[model samples]
Target chain A: MGLRRIDVCGLPPPEPLERVVEALTTLESDDALVVVIHREPVLLYSLLARHRFHWETTLRDDGVFEVRIERRP
Target chain B: MTPGPGLSLTQAPPLSVPFRFYLGAPLFALLAALLLVVQGPDALASRWMPEALAVTHLFALGFVTQVMVGSLMQMLPVVAGAPVPRPQLVAALVHVPLALGALLLPTFFLTHWPWTLYAAIGTLGFSLAVFLFAITTSLLRASAGFPTVGGMWLATVSLGFAAGLGLLLAPMHAGLVSVVVGVRHLHPVWGLAGWVGLLVVGVSFQVVPMFQLTPPYPRVVLRFFVPVLFATLIVGSLLDTSPMEPYVWSLLGGEFFAFAALTTYLQQRRRRKTRDPSLGFWRTALLSLAVCSLLGVFRPFVGLGNTARVDTALVILFLMGFAGSLNLGMLLKIVPFLCWFHLQATFLGRGPVPHMGMFLGDRAGRRLLRVHQTALFLLAVSLLWAPAHRLAWSAVAVDAVWLGTLLVLATLRYRRAVRALAAAST
Candidate 1:
């Protein structure tokens, strides 16, 4: 499945997180998401785990971190 | 400032000169490589024209090696999810000293200036220290399950050894070492093949796929090439110090396998929709490599008639064709992307931002590509059948023009990107 890109800033943390999960679950989309996170968001790992997402993270040379998450089957 | 929806502040901002340095470095190296071809076989012999040594060092130390160092500082983290330690400081310290050392090394050797040699050694030493720290820090931070990452680590270690070997020999110009066997023979091979060659191959394994958007290299090619090259280099170096025919075989075997791996990867590339200019560069390079390899095999039989010509050809092929061509092809892609990527990131969500395609500036690139191709053609022809001095000098003239034009275009593009970012910031 093709990937989608989403940003995690400005919005309240869990709101965007929950919205991502609910949108994916409702549509049952198999698409993956590439998320851009600035600094380490508090409880971000648990929130992802609670939503049962699989993710890989990269910390770029420029100090920004990108986290890729794929929807569960 | 509202970042356009597709853009984000989180995108990694590209460093201007580091990126420009990476591009500019290779262009300068290409200029030097072409000059060597025009200057003929005397360039390689230890007789050492001040100009020739300056140009050679320009490519080896200033251009080729400099590009690799700058590129790794930027790329290693992106590929390996690692952070370079004190990266700005590393870049800030290394670039100027290395350039100055490269500038002075030729003068020192030419004038037989003791102080200049000392200065060269000191500056080169400082640059090497920065390189070592950059490589070590990046490796330590890398979460290395990746083969490319492993290859880079090996290359970095090899580079350290090569630099040390060069330092050990530098004092020999004054006959201080008492080490009779010419270390010069080992220096180029160690620096070019062992250090620069390994790094290029390792990065190409990732970049060819990433940029061309092609499939992964064949499993066997990736898995075996690195180990085989490593084994051969070790065994061959040992043999250089001993009396072993088996080590010679090992080295040749390793080189042949490298050729095979490169060929396989290029053949399988999927970006075959049209006649790519990059392919033209690569084809010349590959042909050069093949010729150089064969010359190595026939070194003992180079006959007095062919000795000068063959030696000249080998150096030209390796330096200009293999290293220079690959650098040109990759830089064309890298420079544009850095421009588009950084520009787009700033305007993310706020307004319309141009796509990568829009930012490519094909008209400008085409002019540079044409000049580059003309220079390459003239150089190859000059190497092949140039019985006339005029023809050879013409090749150098064309190459110098090419470098000057490239530097201008790259500078303009860099300025454009910076302006775009500044405008967005305000």
Candidate 2:
């Protein structure tokens, strides 16, 4: 599977959200998108679910959130 | 690999719920400007003048409180993970009485009509009761941790105290009450320091880091500052008749000074290097707060002879310079963000959505900021030279109208985008 990563750390609200949503539009069925962000995007999960995507989030050691998102099988 | 909490985006109320309050706020500001223009220097001559009282309430109740309530309605669910029940209904019940009371109370202040005072008190009392109940319930249920939730709790309790004091004093101010109460001074203290100050501090904890790309507020501040500030206000109010009152004000001043200094330092170290008009507004607000803090701490000791003008200047600096600037700056970010957020949600995966810039450009925001600064400058001048009151009023009128127009234009853009999205879907 292809992996695409985007770092949205230090970016303000809605910009991070916008970048992730934009990346999702181009995401292939076989690919996973890894997003690195400053904080837990609590509002984004519902949007991802609505668009038939499943995401797993982990708090990295460096204090950033790493989210892996892909289409639900 | 854990999923985030199941905080539903659906909890965010409809755009109209907050927009109505946002859009409605500037009209009261315009009314305040008109009152100033008509009364000229007399309106601002003294804190106890009826005209001054009218104008203060116009800004405090009509503009500041209105926007604050709307923001809480939106933020509680989205930021704190607590949903307010029946948001539209609650908004309606709150907004109508609030707007009515804001208008009637100011009119009563100007006219001294006994019935208007009673009616104002009744409507405002009802509105505050509903708001406090709803917000208090939401805060209790909020899953968010300290600084935000805890701060909100203190602020809401403060509002209850402020509103309670105002209701008790309204009749006394109008000569409707026979008993003389010495706690008349506590009302504004609770309203300004307690309700307004605490809420601003609490909201800034989330907003500055999220929007301005600043580091989060210091942990010590997040944990103790709000609670300490609230306690200080309580102590100061209780000791209004005691010699310790001045020391309390000095302590409160020091706390605010610390907050302002920390925020300024954080902004200087902000990760985002891009030019932002909101930063200018915030800087102006912080500077004003610092100045006000110094004045508060020193005035008692130095003994400024003309207390009336100094008090009026302090009021203008706090209400207009600090609170007003912060409100304007936040609206610049929030209105566009909300518009884009809602539109994106509606058009999910349907097509590319318009970015926030399309809704309200940075240029427009900067232009409004310039006008706001000019108005502020004119207000400062008007304090020194009485004739400048006319110019100040004019600038204020333009500032209010310009802000209202920009917000309306942003809404219009949102509507056009919605129409386009619907057409594409069909």
- The top-ranked prediction according to DockQ is 2
The per-model DockQ list reads 0.05, 0.50
In model 2, which residue pairs have backbone atoms overlapping below 3 Å?
Answer: none
Q: What is the iRMSD in Å for candidate 1? A: 15.6
CA-lDDT, candidates in order: 0.60, 0.86
The Cα error of candidate 2 at residue B426, in Å, is 0.6
Give me the TM-scores for chain A across all models, comma-separated. Answer: 0.65, 0.95
Model 1 clash tally, residue pairs? 9
Docking quality of model 1: it rates as incorrect
Cα lDDT tens digits for candidate 2, A1-73: 9999999988888789889988987898899999999887766776775667878899989899999998877
* Predicted candidate 1 versus true structure: per-residue lDDT over B1-426, tens digit per residue: 111122212123246536645645645554565555566545554324455556667767767677667677767655665656666677768887887787667667657788888899899889888878877877887764446776787778778877787788778865677753435555666676667667766766766664444566778867776656666666666666555633463356347446645664665665543445565555556666666666666565434365655555665567666776666665555555555445433443333434333444445445555666666566567666565334554554565456446545655665675676567657
Question: Which 10 residues in a row give candidate 2 chain B its minimum summed lDDT?
Answer: B3-12
True contacts kept of each: 0.00, 0.46
Q: Tell how far residue B39 is off in model 2, in angstroms.
A: 0.6
For residue B150, model 1's alpha carbon misses the true position, in angstroms, by: 2.0
Output the worst ten-in-a-row residue range by lDDT, candidate 1 chain B: B1-10
